[model samples]
Target chain A: MSSLEIKHLFGLRGVSKHDIRLILDHAKQFREILERPVKKVPSLRGMTVVNLFFENSTRTRTSFELAEKRLSADTVNFASSNSSVKKGETLVDTLRNIEAMKIDIVVVRHKGTGVPKFLADNSNAIIVNAGDGAHEHPTQALLDMLTIEEKLGTLEGKNVTIIGDIRHSRVARSNLWGMSTMGAHVTLCGPSTLVPRNTDLMNHVTWEPDIKKAVANADAIIALRLQKERMDDALLPSMREYRNTFGITDELLECAKDKVIIMHPGPINRGVELDSDIADGEHSVILDQVTNGVAVRMAVLFLLAGGRNNENA
Target chain B: MKMRKPSSSEFPIAVLKNAKFWNGKSFELRDEVRLTSGQNGDTIEYDCKGALVLPALFGFGLDFMEPLRDDVYTCADGVDAMLRGGFYGGLYESAANPIDDADKLTAAENRFSSFGCLGSSFDIKFLGAYSKGFGTDSLAEMMELAESDAVAGFGDGNGVIPHSRFLRLAMEYGKMTGKRFFFQPMDKTLRHSGCVHEGAYSDMLGMKGIPRIAETIAAYTVLETARFLQVPVHFKQVTCGETLELVRDARKKGMDVTCDVGLYHLLLDDSCLETLDSAYHILPPIRSAADRDALWQGVVDGTINAISVNHTPVLRQDTVVNFEDSVPGALSLEVALPAIWNKLVAKVGEARAIELLSTAPARLAGSTPVANNVVVFAPDKPHVVVESDFAGHVCNSPLLGAELPSSILAVYINGFWKEL
Candidate 1:
């Protein structure tokens, strides 16, 4: 498909930097709209959103719910703990059940990849991948870019480094796309194996095994929260060792350029993938990423939840 | 090879002459085999042989092993499975070699995996014809060599390209054989040559070695291969967190991928090699302390499904050499239980050890490791210390004089037990 027009925003697989620019550019106007006299508009007053999370997630579920509520759309949270999914229900069954609820959009965070696309295919509801395995987390990617642009005012030629478990992170996939598309030179620095070694995928992406070298002189550095569940995966040898070598601790921050912004997709591991100091530091845009998640997601919910297009309005 | 009735009933006779071993080199049975009883658990008599025995043992009979340089013809053995094609240094049409440097395999393939073809490289123009020719060569070679000197084919295979090509071949060959193929990709986390664990041992000794990546990548590759093949593939030995994660995540994805951990992997880490005992070196190298803890979790949580000796037999001198230059191998089929128990009983216990070495691996490998590699040890047997009277061709058997619990009595193989 041509990058000229977006056929879908289902996953970051075929989409490129241009799509991200267009989406974020559209999101920028929405951000400005939110700054206007009216906070709630009739853009999506009656449509419904099915927050179908087969995996338990507090921040993603809550953020999407808040985004929907702020956009005046009816939000329904279908958690796996109480759903028939526990009774051997396939994802299709769950999505079908929600489809019967007349939901206009489905924001799903599944433990496996392709579930979002599958849901997007089987039903009329637009499927926004809340997170899908380690593949792609688009909205998180979009909000992070919003956070970057807000601080630096421009992203072109900016060096942005994403550090963490690249192999198992949807966040990394999205941010890499969103940042690189907006003219930022994205460098992914991690243990070489965790970094995607596909050279073509590494377009404009400089893979740095040496963490120190990758973090220095960057306009923005986004630290992904290495899942604690991944400890068993043994991505990092030990928690202490990872924090020392890869974590954005006070010590690591000392190496960053004075204006380098640190953003983490959070529920921080305290001193594991990041130090508590840095997570709560002045240079952090982490809190901003959270704030923008709601707004950008609000925009997404508005668009997907049947907001009138220019012609229809 | 039965001994006289009154030799040593107390120790339990084990056929020591059938001593087979593997080192990515010559296969042989140059001496007498000795057998004894068992130590801690996995109660059965033990005779620590190596991969060289696969051909004799499988004679349409049993199965076993970790990475004793995997199968050349069969898709069952995972590592270097590319050798199955037996076409040295030629191109595998639909396959891509996974390893960055795979051409180095052509010569090895001819000497090892092939029966007749001496051509270099794994180039296969017509898979159907090549595979037929390949399988026919095995028959021809078997008939060519008299029964007295014939080493039966146990599918010792490899490929000429990188690992990816081997994977593609395995998938195609698997379709023909109807065998289950699984995957476990290498965790790209700890990328270099992560030999020993990366924790206290490497840090304290100021030594640098492989971290979690080596095994994790192996595991991830397994999963990816399994996905590509759409088959149930199991990684034979997994060592660290990244690998464990790959297995766990793959399983969660409904991928028919499983993993096994070696006793040494779950027991020792890089710390074991800090003082420089060559016996500590082995492939899918050791991991860090936390990776060790994760291995235990991998075991406790039922994530690691099987265990192997990774039984790549090493000669004593080589194991005793410099750490980097020293070959990484040792037999764990005989010591897996006791070694695990030695390290775990205090923390987890004997039950956990039993689950890891016995019931678990047997179930994973389909009712037990191949017969030729099976050992029946009595838990009450005295520890077999290496460095003293260790069997096998290596004067440098790493465990020599090093007490390995359990005495091996009779090894069950091909419908008969080889007596010591």
Candidate 2:
């Protein structure tokens, strides 16, 4: 199989179907490695990876660290709050200093859009976007895609509904591009205030303000977390009203097809965006998404590390 | 006001031979238009082969932040830059610091007159601020300011007054002075700290979206008020399709309303934000492709009267920040003409472009195109826009590094001809 030829996973907006399949195919191998007792690979033994997160994260950082360790690659973790960034160092300066140490790749997460693209343009090392503001979160979309493909077989002709604050969800943006590119009909469902008006411009993507109508015939339902900070901006009336209007309950699942997969990118607001029972229910693949994240990221790290060899080939 | 006869002794007569000249209405090929020499200098003949000589371009609602922000650019700097871009005159809005009192207005008038006497190849007509400090509630010394013959009209620069009643009151007061009020229509609440146009691009780029409704709603308010009050008002730098329709409807109703679009808005769309480049960041924001096409339609249908540079010179450092943090406005004074000729003239035709750039603006400023004020340009010449080519102080133009398809060859103003 052809390997992914990209140096960075900035977003899924421009990633081709073939490259996505290549990433998924490689992820299968990494998933098998995760099941092994030793759970280690020497594919990236001599390589170095750095987790440079300007934003706070728990699961993504730990997941990346574990993935790097599992591949036998040397890893460094730098949180912006404690680093020289607190001493007024810029994003470029911090990355440049890290690059001076012969780093092979920089996994970055920032609150600013296109930060990874900026670094990828300026630095020689591979730049992987963990998450960047409301722009994109490609790896999250890839893991979610991997989970969907695992549960529902081929993505083509499947109906997938993404419900939440799409205007602020980088996850939603990336998945909109990814799922549609994979030939799935994607429906964006949320409050009218939270859903963007021009989603019809994207292929195979439609927006519905009503949650019931959006999930009625979907084969897969991905519920996004409702950020509480949106209250301050007056984007929402209140958490109680939003939960009443858009929160996914088990009753809501009855609207979808039987055996329809339910997913959420984690740290779920137990009773806000989704019901507590449903989050831990049979249909929910929340934990599986986290498990698949490691394998998907491992595939990403492996393919990008092998990019030079693939280019020469 | 008495029109000055074309004095042969006071103004130099230059024979422009074999050129296409736009004479307020349409382009006509002239074999020779003899210009008599003033006592100051000898008349020189120009063989304007294949050159298009048009009435001097006037920048409506132009801002030069002198006196208040003299460190950025002075009046002389603004005049010199306009001359370089083939413009011989502009209606100067009171910007940064409002010229509210008679003394400040007279000072500005004297400064412009002195600049004119220096043979600067360009003159400025000042628009005294309608309200003190350009505030929404308070009125300035409009009648006294109008006494200075140099005051062309009254404007709040690009600021939209927040209160409708206050705006009506200001217009009522301004009506007595017989000066037209110039304002940009925008609702403060809808535009609330937003930087870019509200659309898919703004959502995807994560920039705050300022909906077209912000402008449309405000335009409706202004048009309704102007219709009711029966006071002449000019809307400056109008951007959206609905606003143009509003203007068209107002004119069909025979309301004395005229509107102008910014040169940047006519040429760019919201897609420029995809690059997240701060250079494209501007007030009122470049809108969607549909909005852009509608703006061009507005131009074609005669709904848009004139085009302004809306030129606010920004320092290079101010533009290098994050897209949201970067200041709005562009250094377009020096590049407006060539950029427009390259981007617009072919689609709209040369005569119409000249009307939008010259006649309409001069008429709005309550001035007629004088015989001596003219620009000669080659419409087919191509030149890349670089920072080095600009004579202005700021280099924050979005068209920097672009190859434009026209160049200004010469400009005649007052009693002198400048070969640019």
Candidate 3:
């Protein structure tokens, strides 16, 4: 039990509670380190890591880059927009070219699902999935868990409701699995059109189509960002309709307990998913979630790099 | 290519000493099964016990992705694969070239026939294209292509022509040709980027799901249109149970419609997609287990006409990527027979199982069974599939590394018994 149960952080679907707890405990220590004046560590001093982003992202990539730099590891950033990927180079060729560079770990975000597992199968380096199309994002969910534990003391026996596009949100998928594994009661609330169709994923959580009733007993609420393309895909009628029905506003919050905390995985659509006042309110842990992201990712990269050592041993 | 007359002495004569022969109705153990070449009509006694002899299977939906350049001898490798897999002949759909005219059809036939002269003779009935590349516009040269005697049927090679004004005109025009129109039924709007059946597994794996309604809606339209035109229609690779129900109802109403299910659809379901293995990433995506059961029932109740060996050869690079990005299909020729015999022997009787691959397809294709062509199979023999077992360049068959219960002992092609 001294080391993590899993070597790679692909997703939280089959991940163990012990592994989640271990990552959270290490993130707590990393949190303390970030508050120091130097804000750096030498845990991974001589290692090399690569950030391979096939999609556009500013937040997750920055957090991972900062975490690698803070750990004193050499980092190489590969973005598909300005690289050989645009020259018709396949994913395998791109991975082989990068692998030839002798990196020790890979943090990849791709539009295709199961890409992390694919990279793990094709390469010797340890893998950490940043996000794969509609699939789980483990570190994001871990940061959410860390934020919940920091504010509410413990996730066990807590009522956490996630409202908004549950079908397409990788954060919702990872949080549902990671949170449920830690003994939290999870509720999913959204438009009937946006509910996930997999009964297995829905089995562990409560699905309430009524938003007021869904948040009434919630100890914590995570609001997901609604992608505007959902309208073009005919999954939603209009943005105004989605905002009126599912947006977290003051009047809708009246049914919730006084001690309830609000959260969002950010770059929030200001007037769409969350109101401005509530996002900046005292009860909101949105900024804290962002702060915890760097620490959680640092814990992940450090552990996976060490996991390679465990395998060698 | 000129046909050279093979000497009579080159023919093979074998007398099976106690082997089970499938006589169309049931398996009968014949003490002395003499198989002589049609050319010489000569026979010799031989000791071959514990083997089952069956008529060589005729595949309906065979596709071989011819290499860009033929210096690799992929055509010869594909023919060897077909013979080793117990297929003597099949309808070969030329996927690379749109066979919109008589010249393209003749070109495809010549390409396949030239392979026959390379020591292995396999019959390939080529289908002509009804439309241009991936569009609803009808081919202006369809009438010329339909008039050719070598052309087997008219179809959209890999794309589906949605039931629109184009389809109505095509079918109405097809009545003059007196040929069957083949359709790969699917609603494109319903199948956008979906790689697997829309069910719990797809939702869990977070891959896009191809809904059953995609096939059902399209099949319903095809059947009703065929009824309206009174033209013969054959549906290729029907995957959904709901589509089978529509076919059953159409057949009951005396409509001139027939359908064939892909062999993989009968053997695999959406559960195999759990690993996200590219081998299971196929077109006419594998449906739910319930749909598979319904497909089996269709085969049993005479609702489905034939089980096609949807043999698509994909390069390794096309399948080595992520699941969704991987190309849809694998080289399924060499593994088709063993997969069918092993999976269907217990479910349906052995006789019906062989007919699904052999006589049923021959009857549907309107081809007479060749006198000397047959397959000698060892049912109890176990062989492990390996990379060298596949003669072609690339194959990502799920059967790779599997232990198949039966092995094809030999196939009678080009009037000689070629041993495997």
Candidate 4:
């Protein structure tokens, strides 16, 4: 249960309650980084991080790359090309060849939800999932938690709403767990067909079919991007209709308090789930989420790959 | 069951019978029948008000069909005394399964009366098995949103039920419906990227192994979940006794739960696995004789309630395995009655065998046998055991259709009879 044992964070299933308390305590130490003057720390200095992208991404990938650089760690981004993929080297072989270079940690974004997890299992160094196939985006979620906690000054007793595709958005999936642990009221808003067939699935989340009701009196609303490419035809009626009902327009913004902030895991569609004005406005934390994304990813890389900070190397 | 009087004025004699299963159909209302008890506190008495007369059928067929569909076909027109509004108010009718459509499912699940257990799957990185999370508020909302018309793959068309998410969903459904939902404990379909179980024949034939660990983990996960939630957990058609011992301990801890063994477990063992007889290919991998012995002990000791057919309708080609490579299960329901009657009576007793086969299974399914769908047997009858002779509805038994001692004479479902 020692804070140092947080090195084994992912090894936590069938774990003792006392062990969980230890990980949370360690997390609390990094949790304090949110309040610092220079949020970037060289805890992971001299380490080399490789961002291997098997699928396309901007927000998570760039944020991770920046997070690594900010930590004074060398960052390498190698995306796959159709030519090599078509030439047919198995993904594992492709990764092993890259891994032969002795990178300290691999920040992987793959289309398979467990691809990063699978890599973590096979690799010698730490593996952080920049994005996984619908399974999880742990770092993205922790940072989202950081943003919510900082904006509201406290996560306990806060009402946070996640609007859009709850089913496919790994952001929403991880956020549900993170927010629940921190004791936030998590409300999910999306089309009924899209709101996940298993509501009984999440223990504390309240599903609202109506966006207005979902965001009303909320401390914050997190807008998730629609993966139009990943979805098939008519997953929703249309982008326009999806916006009319579930989207975040200026009218729906009225449902929130004046101090309520808007957040997104970007590269967002300007007119879809959000307005361009909102994305660029004072209340908008879209950009900040991106900025904090780096900080959070830095914290993750440090904890995961840098061995130990505060503790002597 | 005592009648609870809402007030001193009247005691509601709730004859919650499936009357609609007995309209124009004919059934024998037996006035008198023999009474017999098997294994300690379990017994069969002439609960029937009359000799339930029906057709006599002597053969093999694991049937999922309900009894005669043309009966009273009526429900009280009055509003459900419980819920004030809805067409279901006054009277209730009968159907194969209720809460099938989207609209009624909403009302059925979301009401204050329905806290169906909604569940999700839970596991940590590198964890060999997954744990379960149930009864989340989010799941409650999904129940309200997802109109009822959901059956089996009710949630997703793509079968993308995140193992962790599905556990929570099931528990959530249970919480919502105020009903305990049972999950198939053993899922060989989800294994080290392989389907079907591994058997000794696999080793001999150099086949891929589906280790016992997979099934053990599956059971352990369900057991651990029921322990955490302290809710009713049902592990279906358990074939191994080691697992039953766990359930016994869990139940003793005051978890409202139960377990069942499939008919095959009582009849076959890992010896079947040695054939790599594709016919024996099943999920849990029909295990060793020791395992079967243990399973039988579980049944005799009341560690399990009823014997289930696990009546998986599969094609014969599915069972054609090189080693323990055949599909793991066989169609056993139709032959279930005769199989037990042939093998079990000598081990337990005629009465105990029947209880294991009929009365017990009916109760497990919440099927209250009201004079109909009753199996009448002549205990003294003797029959042969030939693998192919055993009629398994889909494909006859791999034992070349074996014939056991007792023959099935009749089955009465409603007020009618159909010769089988």
Chain A TM-score by candidate, in order: 0.90, 0.97, 0.98, 0.85
Report how closely model 1 matches the true complex, as a DockQ value: 0.01
lDDT of 1 by residue, A161-211 (tens): 889877557788777766766778888887654665445456547888888
> What does candidate 2's lDDT look like per residue over A50-87, in tens digits?
99998999999999998899989999999998999899
Q: What is the lDDT of residue B367 in candidate 3?
A: 62
Sliding window of 10 residues with minimal summed lDDT for model 4 chain B: B119-128
Docking class of 4: incorrect
- Evaluate residue A151 in candidate 4 and report its C-alpha lDDT on the 0 to 100 scale: 74
For residue B277, what is the lDDT in candidate 4?
46
Residue-level error in angstroms, candidate 2, position A192: 1.7
lDDT of 2 by residue, B190-227 (tens): 99878899887878766578988889898888888878
Ten-residue stretch with the least lDDT total in model 1 chain B: B85-94
Q: By DockQ thresholds, what CAPRI class is model 1?
A: incorrect
User: Per-residue CA lDDT of candidate 4, range B1-420, in tens?
Assistant: 111211111111111221212222323333343321111232223232222222121111122111222121111101011111000000011123233344433332233122211100000000001112122123323343232222111221111123555565555454544334454455444444433334433322223445555566677776776567555655656766668878788778887777667667677775554333455655545666777898888877888766655544344443432322233445553345555665675677645655565455444433333332344443445545443332222353554446555544333222111123
For A1-313, candidate 3 gives per-residue lDDT tens digits of: 8578887889999898888998999999999999999999998998899999999999999999999999999999999999999999999889989999999989999988889989998998889999998888889999999999999999999999999998888889899999999999999999977888767768989999999999999999999999989999999999999989999998889999998999999889887899888999977999999999999999999887877777889
Tell how far residue A310 is off in model 1, in angstroms: 7.9
Scored against the true structure, residue B179 in model 3 reaches a CA lDDT of 84
TM-score of each: 0.45, 0.89, 0.94, 0.44
How displaced is residue A176 in candidate 1, in Å?
A: 1.1
DockQ of every candidate structure: 0.01, 0.32, 0.71, 0.01
- Model 3 regions lying over 4 Å from their true place: B1-18, B40-47, B67-74, B116-120, B139-149
